[model samples]
Target: MKLPILSQEIVITLQQLEGIGNKTILSKIGSIVCSSISTLDDLLSFWGNLKGKKFEAISNDDIKEANRIAKRIISRAVDENVGIITYYDEEYPEILRQCTDEKGKIDVPLILYYRGNLKALQIPGIAVIGTREPTPNGVKAGEYFSGEFAKQGFNIVSGLAVGCDTTGHVGALKVNGVTTAFLANGLDWESIYPKENLELAKRIVANNGLLLSEYPIGQSCGRYGLVARDRLQAGLSKATLVVQTGVTGGTMHAVNATIASKKPLFAVEYRNDVDISHEKVQGNIMLIREKGAIPLRSNGIDSAVAIIRGTDYKQVTVTQPSLFD
Candidate 1:
């Protein structure tokens, strides 16, 4: 019997299967945690044994295919300058490991491929996301809320997409506050979506912030990529704030994911002139009126900060900014 931590190659192999959405990867890695798994080859054989006995081994081709996928993922990460951190790795963020569901199930990710300052993971943070194509009111709300949140010393997290997501990052940066962008594409911090935000991404990293992803390099920003990306946005913080979103779209997806994960949500209130009755604002309102997501206030951010720090508003002390500030 050996320790999983001793077999670096096994940990790497498990990370390769991260986005495969397989129960086998979970069980195989969980098996390696304690008892006696020894060498890298032994860990491989353990997975192989599970496939053979617990699961019928379809063919040698399966193992070959798995290895091939692993190589491809790694190659892309190398090309993009992405750093892959397995759950077993010391660099994996500690806050995420503490998530507990209603049933006490932890929603820990297998690996987190990140780019930019790794130190940002240790800092307290909040997320802001909403409609992809926001209206004027939504845009202002996102920016205003983000700027104020950053002022209060909360590191911002967003999907790095357009509309509410990008606005949040921009607002935080405007105030000389730290902000992190989570991407759905490859780990290469060099590229960014909308190509318009490429410079914005650089500014974020330059400001001592981070750009992170779970996927490999050159991975297309597709449906699954966004879904995987959304989880990081929601789970990386104490609360999620939606400036605007339609009843049936990206904002809705993010809001629902946050709810499932049991994180708090705050939707910006509708403006008086904009048709609050429109479908775009429906989701935000629903979260407030039905699902119990709190409403935004001029002071809502202060409340959010208190919640995140687990301190009363008066008890919350301020900290000095680093070089990024």
Candidate 2:
């Protein structure tokens, strides 16, 4: 049977079914499954109708599971004022509509749960990402670069991880500029991973910045989620600044996505006379020498901003209220 047009609530409920992860559903399963199945009933019967009766994600015993899932998510949404924007929704950021994973596959998220100003999504954003265990130089670079970009009217995009990510958000905060934090876990207090940053998350909202996550209220961030969510940092930005990173780690994932998207990448370049070891700046060194990334030395934000403006993309302005009710 047919169901009403795929609603945000229905999309969340459908996610609870087995074999329906975000990457697989949107990329691997393709649009055929989404086009064929309008609701939960179609989830159980679509394969059966095409393949055989035995083909299904769940049996009759779990028929009500979707309802239960929807109830929990909706209840939390009401309780915490969390809002959801899905792939099909017009409010979903166009920058993320074609997010590319590490392998270059189009792994767009099916939905994102958000809190704070939706207006921030309308601004052109530049991602400032780097190591979680940053050197003092990384910290200064992260904060300085973010503050400079924010001063110029570009929103900052980053994960809410400590070290560089925290500095990025705080830099924007320092300037009262808009920033967006793409989290690996849910936006709810209970599930806001790294309990230490709960206050930082709150500050972002209080300052009219945005908090975004693909996970719902109860899920904690795992290693896989941490890695998978990196693409989003690069995906949301016009260009990216690698404040500091090692040769390989989660930050490289964002770097790869930025490169794959054909967006410019600028790596922080410390002076040769500076006492910092090569180990700490290996990522920056390698990127500039081998990866064709731009060298963003200290206080070179003018050049960085110049290159960013040279890109061909239209600015978007959108107005919307924050509260779901």
Candidate 3:
């Protein structure tokens, strides 16, 4: 499907307005003009109405700064060959558009900067997330599950972090399958986080995969941006799999977002005979025993595939003691 392209003016307007934190004001503006922003008159009319209203509280200085930033970002994107997709564009992932937060509010990005195959978003996807530091066993599990899923025509989606997220992308790539990395920073090569994944990001684009981000060019990753990026990881996927994680960290954030979005969640089940004190697998155990995520056996890739495909597959339940116990 050919994605709908937004006009340069509309893209600039959305990018400028993205810094607004007040949802009420942003929503009001979006409702009035998002659909008609292609018309310069409508955009100007909205800007004209911004004065003396709650939106005006943003200040002209802020607006000017935002516009200036938007122009720079656009110039950088063009020079770097990055693609921009707005919420108003049909190219934006529909799954992401349906994602909601704990409050049942639609949680989605207003603008996305991506490098590589935009068609990757059109495929069925499963997000694989876990701790940054994975055990040897955790690495094996991530590779096994992600590779199996990729072979079944599922696009592996991940944060492109170290450990399990990187393993997930590598596993998919090993099968010459499509994988999309959603970064917490900009899509520019200079902005790629974890520096180690720079080569992997290149391989993704070269192999027809995708690298996506909501941040504009030159913006570095922040604590809140990483937290916010988790939702997009979950939102873009048909389901989210926690290969291995500790109780705390970004993996758990993705877990919460997945559940809040009402998407199916699968966590790898550790061997009963093995030591459960392993920190990497602790989050997986907690998710299954406490949060009701389905326990997926390492060899049960078929069942995992079925869950994402919405097929009726045999369900496996784990009765392990809760970590909190």
Which residue pairs come into collision in candidate 1? 1-36, 2-36
TM-score of 1: 0.80
**Candidate 3, poorest ten consecutive residues by summed lDDT:** 316-325
Lowest lDDT 10-residue stretch of candidate 1: 316-325
Task: Name the 10 consecutive residues with the lowest summed lDDT in model 2.
Answer: 316-325
Off by over 4 Å in 2: 1-5, 27-57, 60-63, 272-278, 311-325
The residue-by-residue lDDT of candidate 3 on 1-325, one tens digit each, is 4433445545565456645542533365555543455544545555766644556566555656666666777888989899887766777788887766544578777778999999999999899999888877778778888888999998999988999999899999999999999998988899899799999999999999999998877779889888888888888899999988888877888888888877889988877445268877788888888997888775567666767777753463435432222
Top candidate, metric lDDT: 2
TM-score for all models, in order of appearance: 0.80, 0.85, 0.87
Give a tens-digit lDDT track for model 1, residues 96-175. 66543323355566667777788888877788998778877777777888898888888899988888888999989889
Cα distance off (Å), candidate 2, residue 108: 0.3
Q: List the candidates ranked by lDDT, beginning with the highest.
A: 2, 3, 1
Superior candidate under lDDT, 1 versus 3: 3
lDDT of 2 by residue, 1-325 (tens): 2322456766776677665576654544335554644555665565455343322545644545865787689789878889998886778888888788877878788889999999899999999888888877678878888998999999999988988899899999999999999998988888897788889999999999999998888889999989988899888889998888888878899999989988889888776434146465788888989997887765566667777888332231113321111
